[model samples]
Target chain A: MRWLNTRTITPLLFMAPVLVFAIVFFFLPVGFSLYISFHKWDSLSPPEFYGFTNYVYLLSKDPQFYRTLVNTFVFAGGTIAIGIPLALVVAYSFSQSRFQTVWRSIYWLPMITNIVAVAFIWKFVLNDAYGMLNRGLALVGLPGPGWLTNPSLSMFSVIMVFVWMQLGHNMLLVSAGLQSIDDTYYEAARIDGAHSGNIFWDITLPLLKPTILFLLITNFITGISYFALMMVLTEGGPAGSTNVTSLYMYNMAFSDLRLGRASAAAYILFALIFIVTLIQLRLFRRGGVEAHN
Target chain B: MADAGGIVRSRTLGSRALTVLKYTLLTIGAIVMVAPFLDMFFGALRTVPERLARPPVYFPQTPQWDNFAQVFREMPMLQWGINSLITTLSVTVLQVTSSAMAGYALAKFEFFGRMTAFRFVLGAQMFPFFLFIIPMFFILRYFPLVGGNDIFGKGGMGLLNSYLAIILPFAVSWHGVFLMRQFMMAVPSELLDAARMDGAGEFRIFFTIVLPLVTPGLATLAIFVFVYQWNEVIWTMTVTRTAPNLQTVPVGIYLLRGAYVEEAKMSVQQAAIFLSILPVMIAFLFLQRFYVRGLTAGGVKG
Candidate 1:
């Protein structure tokens, strides 16, 4: 009836923005990206279809592509390997610590600060000769390594800075995860005369598995795709040691103006992220089930 | 008394040690998190010669507070600040309004293809932003009729070099929509039905009743978007490359890397960084509870 028509039209009216966003933001961009991936063209010229060429080139021929991929994995792995555990430990201690608000507010500082500022802050702090870190090392009569400039340690410096920036954020999430855990489990463990170490291993770790997995997958995705820090800090220099796929893709598209191959690189990186996420989901199905709840 | 005190101390020794260790780690961790910010603040106040000195002066002996005011003198910081404020505010407003409307429709309406729409939002979030940057750049460059483009979206820079370029891409946040739906679900159907019984229109019901009830949720989403958009650089930096007029604080500071390369201007750069990051810090200090609430509630993406 007329009433039913009004209801249908009203909902549709409300959904106008969503429809527009879907078309312009999601569907069109994705469709255009896919189309560009299969063809070769600069923005100046009409695209020419050359099936599988870009993909094939990136996978088999492009010297930098595979290297960037490896760098990305290492970056992701390094961020998660270092960031998560440190966050977990800090979070556990935070749950019991005095001055809860002060500690949290301090830790939460970096999470809110822009990544550009974060990178620049570390750029100064980690400077080889005039840096706070190196100066402190010199005070203790320790050798100060070239953190940002060195070819070997560029990625390591990037990871450590990222870890520092992310520590607060990860700690907050893990602390929440730590909070979700029922206290009765700890009570029961203590009743059985369990030592602190045993309680941590047997109860806390098992219960905390779900949160840890969530952090791992999320941080891994962020780590691999992230390049702004490296972009600002080293510009993927020191013999491309810090260059990840995302950064490489950014440069390919913007700097080199190879939109076609850049689109292909984006797809490849997306696929890698997608595949790894699926594998993670499958691997942590049991813990993940709890995570969703 | 001595024996009693000794017995009490012995009984509590392990627990006391654990507490001390926990506090110690937390204090050190807190310091590590905040020390860089202190370095930036101190560096901002140091004189040019102090910064350029061998093994550079760690502390500012006289503390050239002029550097803070000099950031404005050195760059178009006021314009950058304005641009940052405008774009972030516009995106936050657009995202929150659209999210509320769409989220309300999806949650409350029993329309055809509702599930598909909701599922589309969920699925779309999976496609990372990196995938769209190149195509989206061309799409905007070729966008019809704006920025002097003709009907076919040709012969112009399209949306480039405009405030729209920075604001348009972020106008609709899928996560905001999803989070809003979760918030709207908390609104009882009875309230809306009662309003309907009183002959109130759907929009009226949403505006007057539903909107007020979800103020907390709206605040949460606003904080998320404000923080995220205020800090968003990659896309903004990409689009605003040639459009220095449209660049935000982060992009301006970052792209102006050349200005800071000199030793004399180094302190000025640090001062600029300090100024740029202050607003968000202030906002966070005020609204931190929202962040904790939002993150824990839905595991909201930061």
Candidate 2:
């Protein structure tokens, strides 16, 4: 009974599991990875300290690394540039429509489904010879290009599928943001003879800036780290056009057995993402988006 | 009176037109979103001849219900399903329990390093999982005394080729702890204080009073983890690449794509995909509100 105070001991006891996990899974792995990045090791042999060579090779010597970096940026930038606006439009429509729940559930179907399933479904739909998209194109007298097989179009195919999968979730976020706006804003705008388009642009977009920024930052982070879809859909194939950095790192570590180089690649990507995130935060603060939200 | 009525009528007409346009666009978008799934189901039922035809058949002349059964016969569908359930369920339960305990501590208890612990959780979430996969894989592989390894962790695939490999790294989620902490902060301190005054133990207070109150948060986090882990491919595929016995459904399907190269086998692959997606779809259908709440609360990283 004396040990029951709501102070140091009780909280420490409760936090023990998480503390252990943080040390073991979080801290240990991160530290070990950083150490590995500095040394050369294959699983069979002891690690040899190699000093910045791994980073040097990846940054300057490796052509594939540069290609993957470009591909990763393309995927992330394309998804944000296209997906966020598309999602906002759909969400704006959804927020204004009837049977919102039903529409939301339908759109969310792809989001809940696994990446493998989405990739495979798209695989079937984008089949060069007899797929649904091609069939539809044929029906309308339009030629269907190779979606996943052509090097030129493979990255586009992945981006389109990625956007489609992410649309519902982003739409939900935007819809939530849309719902939070005060009805008085719309009413006042209408009273001033503002058209719906003017009201949306002037009132909704300004008020929704926080949500949009949140979506942009998070989606950019996710898109950069994402590789499962590329792994399954293209396996970074079609002349390696679809290869992103994460997937490239995975192959380097596993397939190429260059554990040291893979860790370095991962850290470089992490640094890039971290810096971008900081920049986004600074921009948001400067723009006063946080103040409004 | 006539002019005022005419203005009102015109305004109503404009609004009605907008509504019609909105519904039409949304309906088309919904169709695009769902039609691929319909195509998958139809593709799974198409006969070999129909599939091989020049333009390809959009609909099956006769629905091949047998493809679903053939999936089991041709592949280890049952094993993959069981593995997915075991790993997903284990990760979910462990994550929820760990997060709740840690969250409760951070929310209610006054302790040293409390701010640091919370900050660690926040910073850790920003560390994308790609950073951990390389070292974590070796850590599991070289773990001493678990899988016939020596005292020095030298041999025998330490924890690889087992459910533990998949479940261990995910046992505690930083986001889950953060989310739980946020939820638990709202729980009144007075209730726990009253329970303590009535001679209840800390564990008892948590289980009986605190836990029940945060069940919504628990459920939200549980479903979120469950769906994510169930669909997790990269980590599972990496460790279980050679261990087919432990491959989950998504990993199994992707790895076994070579088996479905023939047109006849394509239907089987599509059927397998359908089956793999079924469980999460059913769960989402039932518990969508909680999922939405979870997504909005976290606001990122699904």
Candidate 3:
């Protein structure tokens, strides 16, 4: 009885380091962020309590805020929409193919490469004066627009980079899901004269729902937090057209030192992501619990 | 026999068409993924005149293996690599250990505040760290401790611009903890019960028994943490601006890009970028099995 009771203490002892670190660094910051959201603080001056002022201005008066919010959604939505399907097709192909190993490694190369480095290389490729894209376009007698520098194309440019970075991981996930499907089901479908497309629609998509939903939720969360690439590729503008919520928050906190407003903006983003993730988790029942060791 | 031969011929045509479409799509994807890298490699090798030419050199006639040496001479390339390795490995090791222990607790033990603690970890993963940059910077630069300072802890720079500054704040990752816990949960409860019957202490049960069982999961998290910490730039840029010696590889390459003045220095920048990412590229090649196993196994459990 005494030994059984003592086991509890040992687990707590082991967990104490991580617990303390999380409390001080992770949880404390989150709580502090919430508190800071209500104050009017720049680094130079002490924070003054200004309840709801930052939130109000952000909602009603801030023009750039709305644009950033829309851009964040568009960027996330566009990347996810394109990324998920392409991942599905590629994963399906690789699942049924012999060269899966070689293909998987090639595709995953971009994801592990430094985003800043990737963005820099792509910047050279997207340069208006002598970019490869333009050169190729000229050969085809088509005009190449300013990819990164132009406001119209900049968001798309960033999204394309995101999609490229993410494709490998997502495709692998989808392929893993495909591998889990029993071959017998596919054989039976074939015996029933079900075409490949029909079999995929009926069996594969429905069966892969959990995996797909997992990708969606994680991608949405990761996509909104995509400031790393933006910093290198566009710095959020020819104008602020390419600024996502994360970049906007970064600029507010660091560049402008509007710590109070930045904290408010961060909380708002947290709230949005939390609610959406909650809904998806309930609907899809994916990624709510840990799935390892 | 003739009718059967015709049916076989039609099926062959169908399969060939499918293969064609597949290759076409893959070719397009391959181009998108490989083109930028090809550009980087070719640009680094090109002469200054070739780079500045009206139509830039798409393909260098000769690959300049010497550009890497030139990059090494221009910047503290080896120093940056060493710094990056130190920072990344320090963080990764600490994170894996802490995550494993906490994960074991979450998985096996029935403690008070367990669900609440787990939820807090989950929620923390969603709150982007970008929001904390300015405040976190001030705290890192001004935190009170052993260093001599006023009561408010604002005088001496405590952790700022040191390797500790880069590593400590990010060492505790909620996602890693969550990942470990999920992996631990998949281990059979009977194993723990048997260890208890064998008079094993809780620490022995966790370290000797559970830890070994979760080796594959730990490897996955290790790879993720290694690659992520390797590529990180923003926090490194913000915290260690003064200490060139403390700068990680990504930040070093970024600084070189910003500071390059000579027209010919562009190739060096390209070479620096290439060399900076070379370790990770090589790691990807060699660690393919561990990486895939980690992702798939980790995916299912989490």
Please give the DockQ score of every candidate, comma-separated. Answer: 0.60, 0.60, 0.53
- Residue range B178-295, candidate 1, lDDT tens digits: 8888899999999898999999987888899999999999999999899999999999999999989999999999999886788778888998998888999888889888877777
Best by lDDT: 2
What DockQ does candidate 1 score? 0.60
Against the true structure, what is each candidate's TM-score? Answer: 0.96, 0.97, 0.93
Model 3 lDDT, full chain set? 0.81
Q: Supply the TM-score for candidate 2.
A: 0.97
- Model 2 per-residue lDDT at B146: 89
lDDT of 1 at B157: 94
Candidate 1 runs further than 4 Å off:
A1-4, A288-293, B1-11, B300-302
Interface RMSD of each: 2.8, 3.2, 3.0
| Cα RMSD, model 3 | 2.9
lDDT of 2 by residue, A1-293 (tens): 86656566888888999888888888889999999999998867889999999999999999999999999999999999999999998999999888888998999999999989999999988989788999889889999999998999999999999999999999999998898899999999989877677988999999888888888888999999999899988999899999999999999999989999999999999999999989998877765555111
